[model samples]
Target: MDSSSVCHAEHVPSCHAEQKRSIHTGWRADVWTASSLFLAKISLRPRIEVALSTLACMRVPVAFLLVLALPICKSFYCYISETLSTACMPVVVFVAPLCNAAALASLEALAKQPDISLGVISHFPQEQLPLHIRLRLAAHWQTASALNTAELLYAAEKMHTYFGKIDVLLSTNEHVQEALALIREKFGIAGMRPDVAHNFRDKARMKQRFFEHQIPCARFQRLTSRQAAYDFVEQVGFPIILKPLCGAGSVSTFFVDSYAQLEPALAQLNPSEWNVALAEEFISGAEHSLETVMHHGRAVWQSVSRYLPNALDVMQNAWIQWRIIVPNAAEQVAYSDIRHAGQAALSCLGLETGISHLEWFRRPDARFAISEVGARPPGAQILTLHSRAFDCNLYEEWIRLMVYDQFSVPTQRYACGVAFLRAQGYGVIKHITGLDEVMRECSALITDVQPPKLHATPTGTYEGDGFIIVRHEETAKVEQALEYIINTVRVTLG
Candidate 1:
């Protein structure tokens, strides 16, 4: 086929236009040679052939390299795209693993197209893969899997064998350092490097940093022994927060209101394993979080969210409910100062070029102080909600920033907010009410409403029982709708 025909056949409109332009400019011969080399492999693979062809038409060198490498090395690309696609829609996935697998399987089926080649592979053990391929795969997997797991070690060794230019590694979990080292040796990306992730994961160390930085935070001390904890209370007084240093999702987080409650609280923990706990002066106020994208020592995009009734209190109650508010324009001025302070704190901590979730408290006087900063996306599907409200794909933005050092600036077209619905009392969930009505009534302003399914009881208050994320061109409408939903909807349990 002629180059134009080939471009059209490959569904690369841009390529055809460019080819026509080049021909008119007397560069037809050179253009044809390049196009031929690019399309040489289009006939080789059917499943990803289209993706490959699209990449070829765009003349993306990395795509070409990956295409060439695919045949020589057994590699699988897992697309979590479906997760984002179906997230905002009204759908209940009772089984998370099943949903993930089905999504991957459907993507695999789609890969059967003439333009696509690679297929989705299940998360199988290393032993199932070819011995040669197993080595590199092991290294990448070690970052996600437990080090003690056999698969992790296998992956680490495999990673070391392939890409060896890495130098530094960062992990919050102490159990994964050895795997990090192995992967560093294998791929040479960099040896394990000390980072704030370690300190953030270790509650005691995190508090120490805050103290050293003179960052406003609760008065706190860490203890490993029961006697020490008791002594700490004697010195600092009662009613403190206690939790594991490296745990997520508020797991095992408890509040000791008095010395009388300390022992029972301690009983719930394994001092030998849980080891460390923080005794801190509890600050009473509204809790809010600043989500930021920092680059080159500056915060580029920042979002401020106020937790309804507060997350700490919600976690402490463990049986009550909570929601979150993304302030409208009128409240922006008040929160902007907090966002600036958060950005400054992140800058001081040497956090640059990544997404950060910083929790803060706004005291009665309107003063703000940092609670903690995590070097990852905020939990509770917040990213999805933000994307829905702003018409921006944060994950995609993050990927671009990480890979290409570029991000899209969001057009502030509408104000968006999410309010989480939580169980009123502990028991099996009888039902979730008001989602249909909320969607129908606020259809003009509400972008998405995802309520917990019937029988989907929550195990903890912080489990994100359900959420309603909305976007409105006018800030007043957004606020009114949010108030209406909060006042009307109820998550009842038997």
Candidate 2:
């Protein structure tokens, strides 16, 4: 691969074409870079005169001149709107566990955006990423631990060395949001602050905000000691949920149903001040996820997805195949209640600008309760569903929203759902059955399928080995297709 070019991951053999294009683009960038340095050191009159002269002499394109004026243009726009650029490419540092599928997808989206210099900070080496992704990055820094504050700060400094002025810091991983927020603060970057990020990252703090704002959420307490755990159990009674204060997904989460389960749960939790746990009342209701896009401290756009059964249930039952549905008319009047409540929750939690994934419940009595929310894009192909439903690229939308504060909201065009295929009696996948039948019946509806490889070990997560996505215009039809898939497909394990 050439040093200057980035081939799309899907198209690697044409690397030379990409490199040639990059080489041509470099002349404009060279002008931008050198002129920017001189403009910074000189006064306003000379800066403008020299910049204009240089551009005219080089016969720079009109677009290149506009790129030079991006800062002034953004200032005018922001001031008028009670707003927000540069010839120098804006530097954005994305932090995550690089090897994860979601991170790779998010990175690809960022790379596709024009004019911005992208840098990556992660726990894994740059080689962990696809060659195409590595070639696109202006720079990559590996930290001993992505979560460590000092290491992150050092990495940011190194990225700054390569690409001047770290303008925006972002991460889609829920596990590293707060750490990234802390780094953002240290660098004086304009984004979510640590205090606000804490409200979303720490469940205990999050629930406190909910209580203060009078938002209906599960009854929860921060277990500080053995006695506190016992007291919480006494208050909430049997069938409680125990989870890490800042856990992502269902990892390290426990569902205790009786007295006999309490001791084992407590033993596993090992609750203490340094390692506190959260115990909440087990909510018995239909679970759903709300994806909200917040701008200027308000909810601007939103979507919803329903879990066939909650994540915890799937985590407990390895044999269960998980499914998620994105209704065609998700924003209909039926979801009006959640829309109002979810927006309110985002406001109180201090989501200034970005996408948030909130988990909530609709009780048997037809009331809603906020379970938790992450100040980042959701996982498990939820965004993929939105892309199919709306006929737009949500990954690119999310990138633009975070990096440029712009969103071209897409209209919903279809309903979509995903069925996770988990093999029964897992050790390694030995056989897959019923796929042919599914294709014969639901060929037109199916959009994508990732089949498990023979002899592959189970992933041991709720998402299971592989998944199939189906899309349609009617919500009921999508649901029926998902049900049919779950009943038909079976992956036999050795």
Winning model by lDDT: 2
lDDT of 2 by residue, 228-318 (tens): 9789888879789998999988888999988888888889888898989999999999999999989898788888899998999898998
Q: Model 2 segments beyond 4 Å from truth?
A: 1-87
lDDT of 1: 0.55
Residue 107 deviation, candidate 1, in Å?
A: 12
Provide the lDDT at 67 for model 2: 84
Local distance difference test, each candidate: 0.55, 0.81
lDDT of 2: 0.81
Span of ten consecutive residues with least summed lDDT in model 1: 89-98
TM-score: model 2 vs. ground truth: 0.82
